[model samples]
Target: MEVVFERVEGRRYRVGVRRSGRHDTGPDVPPRVGVGAPVGDVPHDLVHLAIEEALGLRLGIFGQVAAGGDLGGFFTPPPADRSPLRDKRRSQRLARAGRSDTGLSESLAACVGHDGRLRGADELLTPAELGRVQRRLTALVDAWRATPPGGELVVTWPEHLTVRRGVLPSD
Candidate 1:
């Protein structure tokens, strides 16, 4: 799969994916999936969730930075204590905070659909705290491409900042 990260404006970027074929030129061509956001607009929580779901790396925000900012530093979580009361309390807290563990899945569903059309382009992230999140995302993407779990995955950021197919890695 080819993933193109195109700058739309300022720090805003749009991610597009194509499952097959080389980059083509045409107005009618549509990516298999697409999502757009400013670099600062991408949530740290969501990035962490996506890394966990897509790469099976459970390096939580705190631990990720402490481990020298690499995927190899990820470690398995300790087994949770099987307590029904604790589970109930945790669920209630999450509900109150309007957060869910399925953040990655829900975000993907909102952005990319079965028809591959883009959606939810207006969701704005909270202002970045210290630019650490952006750095974290870059590191995560580099690690993902280095050892893609499923197959060859390519991610590119266009120089001209247009929503066109980026140069493939093989090019």
Candidate 2:
């Protein structure tokens, strides 16, 4: 599976954890779940963080579905027909994207130079420190389940999903 991104509206964005396969590129591309906010120029670090976190959760969900007694003896494999080597490569990409230390933060701060108020995750990471950003993201996901019913915030799973075949780029 690959991480695909789409814009809902304005800064609101949705990133899909799509299994490879299928060519319908319209609004109905791969079955994707929304994560974080929609964005136009998302910083490199946030994109990586969102993809890694979302993929990890989706994999867990797949495992659960396969293990459910309803599946019976049927077994489901991991996404993308990925071998262990391919999986490692994908992981490395995510790690690289998510890498943000104090230095990047300092540089980003100088660039922005108090130009505007921070929005979304930016409010919490003006310096773009990875550890701080990761902690904030954990808090957000924890609250995902606690969002009140019918609230603007919601976390849901599709009725069903199938992972298809596709080539994931090393970059």
Q: Report lDDT per candidate.
A: 0.32, 0.32
- Cα distance off (Å), candidate 2, residue 77: 6.4
Ten contiguous residues minimizing lDDT sum, candidate 1: 62-71
Residue 49 in candidate 2, Cα distance off native in Å: 8.9
**Clash count, candidate 1:** 0
Question: Judged by lDDT against the true structure, how good is candidate 1?
Answer: 0.32
The alpha-carbon RMSD values of the candidates against the true structure, listed in the order shown, are 18.3, 14.1
In angstroms, give how far residue 56 of model 2 lies from its true place.
20
TM-score for model 2? Answer: 0.23
Steric clash pairs (candidate 2): 11-38, 12-38, 13-37, 13-38, 20-164, 20-165, 105-127
Count of clashing residue pairs in every prediction: 0, 7
TM-scores of the models, in the order given: 0.27, 0.23
